[model samples]
Target: MPIISLPVIWIILIDIIAWTFFHLLISVICLKLSSTFFLRESYWFKIFWWEKSGKLWQKLFRVKRWKGLILDGTIFLKKGYDKKGLHGTKISDLKTFAAETKRAELTHWLSILPAPLFFLWNPLWAGWAMILYALLFNLPIIVVQRYNRGRITTITSPNK
Candidate 1:
């Protein structure tokens, strides 16, 4: 019987241990920040749409990879331009939209680092974390969407 090299075994062991710890630590931190801090104040955020794109895709395609792609996609969209702006041709309307964008820009800054950090460390774990986070977060959104489904959404359309 041949004995394995100590360094090789040690390296493999370290990789597994590090990977597990990284997953756990990142999950806990994101959960705390997302659930307790940011989403706590706004049930809409906690329950409905924080990273919903992943789940949507997962449902659309039977493929497992869609899970991460959906989550990452939603995060990217949420961090993108505010959806409340009007597409008026006039300069004044554009200026007004620019001045008072409804979507929170600060959320982008807050959620930015955690996703990328986790992703860089391990895409697999990060994707898992994102999926879990999105599901947990969507509980509130579902309620809101249902509650307000037929209700008239007030849209302050800019006068062209």
Candidate 2:
């Protein structure tokens, strides 16, 4: 049960405002940080033993088929890096692109952290819905980032 109660309309409004606020806040913060901050593949962004360099997602989720459907959110940001398509094949460009995938993935992961805050005012079901919304909204982008990062970094890696 919610610790506090609001009418349905108020709850809906709060959900919209809260989600938008958190999304933009996280995006802007991530954008301002140096791309080099994400340039190295952190543990969270690396291909796990289970990931098979992201091929696991392709096998289990058919990522290649639906990856094109993901809309790049950078268009909404005036200065954010556009990751929709690679701008060049140079090693420098590839490195930046790889870093950007990490950045994008981290942004979406951070975006989901606020979902539980909705439970403070929303009923049990709606609060759960918020968590679901967060996952549904972010997971596709997250998966695409992981998959692409692996491919990009593999090419960029001298050891590969």
lDDT of each residue in 49-68, candidate 2, tens digit only: 67777787788888999999
Per-residue lDDT tens digits for candidate 1, residues 1-30, read 112223545644644565456544543344
Score candidate 2 by lDDT: 0.88
Superposed model 2: Cα runs more than 4 Å off? none
How many residue pairs of model 1 clash at the backbone? 7
Note the Cα lDDT for every prediction shown: 0.35, 0.88
Supply the TM-score for candidate 1.
0.27
Residue 149 alpha-carbon offset, candidate 1, angstroms: 15
Compute the lDDT of residue 41 as modeled in candidate 1: 27
What is the C-alpha RMSD, rounded to one decimal, of candidate 2? 1.2
